[model samples]
Each structure stands twice: as structure tokens, then as C-alpha cells.
Target: MVGDSSYGAMSIEELVKFFQTGKVVGFPTDTVYGMGCLLSEDCVAKLRELKKGREKPFAVFVPDVDSAKELVEEFPNYINSLIKKHWPGGLTLIFRAKKGLPPGVVSGEGKIGIRIPDFPPLIEAMKRVGSPVINTSANLPGEVPPVSHKDVRVPLELMLKGDSKGGIPSTVVDVSGERPVIIRMGAVKVFEIEAITGKTILLSEGNVLNILYVCSGNTCRSPIAQYHLSYCARDLPLFIRSCGTLGFSGSPATENAIKVMEEIGVNLTAHRSTPISRELIQWADLILPMEPVHREEVLSLGANPYTILPFYEIIDLEKIPDPIGKDIEFYREVRDLIVKGNRWLEKHLRERFNP
Candidate 1:
């Protein structure tokens, strides 16, 4: 009704009414073209028939957080954190299904995947329908899902003509397990997930090294090391973050730290300090701390002893001192030290990750 003229067009209100009455419709999503219907048994059966008898559990499209909450069993704090950061976008979270969902809504393992899609009109339609809809890619199983409404092969009662910001499918995270597991890697990267929940996430793709750099305030040493190493090892399979053991959250990197990094063409102006958290310590495959005291703090936060390696100790270099109140020259010296350490680390990571 919105764009393509091949099919019968309908107003959004009419579309909502059709959905409420269990008619399948095709539409654009933030990620790709999709077809959906109400979660009623007859509607789900028709949706499956349209997809050529595919039987994989379909993701439920919920309009809002409250709607999502009603469909799943209780979730953990980290799941809530991920929802806060990634919802209304291209991330689908799977949780243990609560009882009494429609037959096709829950997988055999009793888990249900749900997403609050970024598309405004579709979300509004679901909100108006007052029930979750069964959403699946707009193609037969094993076929490339359509990115535009015109490319859709499956016939529907109506196709809401629109464009899809197609890249990869939504990233799927399963929180029904003892730990969060990434069953599918799509639009969202592993590093972005780690930044939000501070838990190292392994993909079905393979292993990825996660490094957490720590310092006193996160404004000087750790930021320098994090940015320098990130720039040097841009292609490696690594996720890097910096935090302060005894630091203020949301504090910007010092002027000296920013200026020194600029000399080497690495931008530190965007770096903001975050205090080291238990989630962060748990997330790191390797924890590189600026000083021995920082390493001790990381250990105090329940980090594995094997994971906490002081940077100077590991590289056999003298400890890089903090340059908070020091002159620009001192900051430059610190930057040089971090560069030397990062150079050694880069070569080591290259050998290990082979990226």
C-alpha cells in the first residue's frame, strides 16, 4: 500500500486489522524484507505454507519492551542491559519461553527469539494489533531473503512497499543458557556486545581474543594503550576496551593524553573513562594493567590470576607511569612506552589470531 503497485494496496489501519484477523503480510524491516502474521495457530500455519513448508522457529516481533517481557520467562540483568543498548535495532534475543505461547512461537527447546524492530510503521501496526506477530525472513528456506518489497517472492495479502537497510541479518543471542551464547553473528559485532555487557562472547564463527586494558584513572595510560594497540592491530580478531581501577566514569581523556596520541595520528579525544567492573574483569581473555596496583585491583574484582598480566611485567619493560599532572613531554614519553608495548603485543596477536 505504501509503494509497490503490483498487489492490492491498503491503509496502515486496514493492514493492522488484517494482521489482527490473521492475514499474512509482507513488509520491510530494519534488516531485510519479512512476512508476518498473528501468532494464532491458523495464521502461523498459513505463514509456514507461504514459506514453502519451512518449520524453523520464527522470531516474534514485539512492539515494545513490555510486550517482549510478557512472552518470556524472567531474564537476567545482563539481558536487560543488552535490551537497553540494542533494542529498537537489529538484534534478536532468545529467552526461555513462558507457558501458553502459540504452537509455532516457541522452539522445541522452549526458547523464543524476539526483537523490537527499528521500523516505525511496522512497530506501530503491531502496537495497534495488540499482539506479537510471527516474523520470518521473506523467502523460502535457504533462499536469500529479499531486501526490497519488490524482490519478495512469496505472495501475501498486502505488501507494505518500503526499503530495507539490508546488510546482515539481526544478530541472535541466546540467553536461555547458563551464559549468553551468540548462536548467529549478523549485523552486530562481538566487540559491541562485549562493550555493553562486559562478557566475552564467542561466536559460532570461531574464537576471538578479548583484551581489557586497565589503569588508575582510564584517562591516561589505559586509553593510550587501548587506542595505540587498536590502531596497530586493526585487522586482528580482537575486541579491546580500557577502564580505570580507581577512576571516574564519563571523564574525558586528559588534554596531555589527547595531544600525545594525536602526534601518532591516533584520536583520543573521544575516549571517556569507565571504572573497572566485575563484568569487565570477567569479560577479558587477557587483562593488561598499567601498574601492579591496577592488576591487584583487577584481581580484587575476581579476575582470574592467569588473565591479569601487568603490561610492563609481560613485556619486560619498566612500568609506564601515569602522566595526569605532568608536562606534554612526560605524556609523550608515556606514549612511546605504550607504543613499544603495543608493537610487541601486535606481533604476538598476529601470530596467535593469524588475521
Candidate 2:
């Protein structure tokens, strides 16, 4: 906080020196202007007191994602995906804290919020500091967090310049729980989170491979293939779903295909169809198409055909016959072919996604 040594503004070199001397300063984060001090009890106490000692915990900001993992117990799998998607942006993720952080940051909650600020100089300063900063917004308690440097309330030895892009604060989530709980919905939306995470928000048991099956129409082959593959992968952590290339969003799986899948121990009675989406394609580590046509569709979405290759590529077939409106035996035959095709898929998966 500013004091007798108040500096109107400081160069990056001066800012680095301020941090080295155990001083708190005002700076910009991607979300808003921020107040930070070197990670130490005495410095944090000074910062917390200056910032009005608000009840909740402060975030510990690292230079980057790897630094974040260093101060936490375990970084979940989905969290790594999120870090890739939104680091250096407005997203505060809570992880179970490791010791050595200031008590004020953890606040005896045994959880510490981690942020990787998108601000360049701030990130550079953090890199040089070689430690985390007690990253909290620059404001008095219960006031709007400052986006522009002009609005900073906490006194500082120096101020970093920038108009804070203040639209929404960083979205906050606690991944230290059994599921990711949305504690605050600010910059990122639930659907966007789901798109990147390949998950329905707050509805998960643990990390799983997101597999999407693509076909001409969702009502038959794709659903049957995914359900059967899901059945085979029951012991593995895999989330399987199907989509159609024709934009058939709500059709049901053909009755014969559903019945045949049931014979194999996968229940498709509740399967609902979805259309192939850019979101789904992005979400999937592997986009498996039932035919060459489906593969082309996936490739049009900027997908690499190497990843979305047709299942029959393994079985030496030109195409996997669509068994829509077919008798149960024909459906059963296609199911058997798909079951064998998965062996090729397993090998390719190990070489490609290896998830």
C-alpha cells in the first residue's frame, strides 16, 4: 500500500525492486487492477490490513499454470484442461492448499485460490519474484474492484498503468471438491466451461475420456456404436455420446438398434440424439465417425482426419452399413463389426490421445 514512499508510477525495473523490498503495489490483472505483495506472512498481513481485512481468502497468483500446481495438493485432470483454455485470463480456480502460503491467503480454509494474471508486466514481475503474490483486487472491502488504475483505493508504493478491461470479474470455481462447484460466475459462463471441459457443469464423478460418435443420422448407428463402446469401456472412465451430420438434434435411436444394444448390456432406451457441434468437436479428444461421410463433416470443422477416421478403416470396409429400420439380426451384425473395430481404436488411442 502507498505510504511515505508513495510513487506516482514506476517502471518495470522499479516495480521489481518494490517487490524485492517486501512492498505491496497496485498493478493490473487481465480482469481488473490488483493489489499484491510477495508471498509472506508479514507482507500479506500488511496487504490484508490495507485492503480492509475482508472476511474471505485472498488468491495466490503464480506466474503461470505450473507455478500454481506447486502450491496445491493435487491439480485435477479437468483443471489442467481449464488451465490450458483460460490461463492468463479471468478465471480463479481453488485448489486444496499446501502449507507455506500466508495464512491470510488460505485463511484456515485449507483451500487456496490460484490465478495466472494475463497482464504481461505483472506476469514478468511474478516470474522474477520467483514466488507467488497475494493477488487480490485493488479496492476497499465491499467496493467495486478497480479496472482502471485511477480507481485504486489501496495506497501503493507504485502503480501499474492500464485501463482495466472491467466487464466481469474472473469466474471462480472450487475444483477441490468431488465436482467443480461454481462459486462465482463472472467472466466465463457454465456453457463455455462445459464446452472446453467436455463436461456438464458441476455434474461429474471424475475425469473421463469425452468420445463422440458421428454418423449420417443420430437415430441408429452412431448411438448404437457409442453405447456398445461405452458398455465395453464400462470399467474405464469414458463419457460416450453420439451426433448426426444432418442436424438431427432430437431423434431417438432406431428401435432395432436400441434393442440389439440392449442384448449386449448397454441401455439405449434413454439415449437422446445431438447434432455434431463445434463445441462437441472441440470437447472430444477423439471424434470417431461411423463412415467416411461423417469423417468429412468433422474435418470441415477444422478437425484432423487422423483423429476422426471412420471406424471401418480398421475393418477394411468401405463403409459401416446403416441398419436403420433393419431387423434385429442386421443391427446385431453391425454391432459385432463395431465391437471388433474398437480394438483398432484402442491402438490408435494409445498413439494419439493416450488419455
- lDDT scores for all predictions? 0.81, 0.75
Tell me, by TM-score, which candidate is best. 1
Can you write out model 2's per-residue Cα lDDT over 44-100, one digit (the tens) per residue?
Answer: 788768877766788888888889889999988876677887898888988899987
TM-score to true structure, per model: 0.59, 0.55
- Give per-residue CA lDDT, model 1, range 1-355, as digits (tens): 4434222324456668778777888877889888898777787788889988878888999999999989989776776777886788889999999999887878999999999988777777787778888899888777898998888878777887776875468988887765567777665654567557766454544556689999999999999999998898887767999999775899999999999899889999889999999989877878998888887898889886756668987668667788889999999988898898888878766644331
Q: After superposition, how far is residue 203 of candidate 2 from its true place, in Å?
A: 10
Model 2 scores a C-alpha lDDT of 0.75
Mark the regions of model 2 whose C-alpha exceeds 4 Å error after superposition.
1-10, 203-355
State in Å the error of residue 27, model 2.
1.0
Shift in Å, residue 229, candidate 1: 16
* Candidate 1 residue runs with Cα over 4 Å from true position: 1-11, 205-355
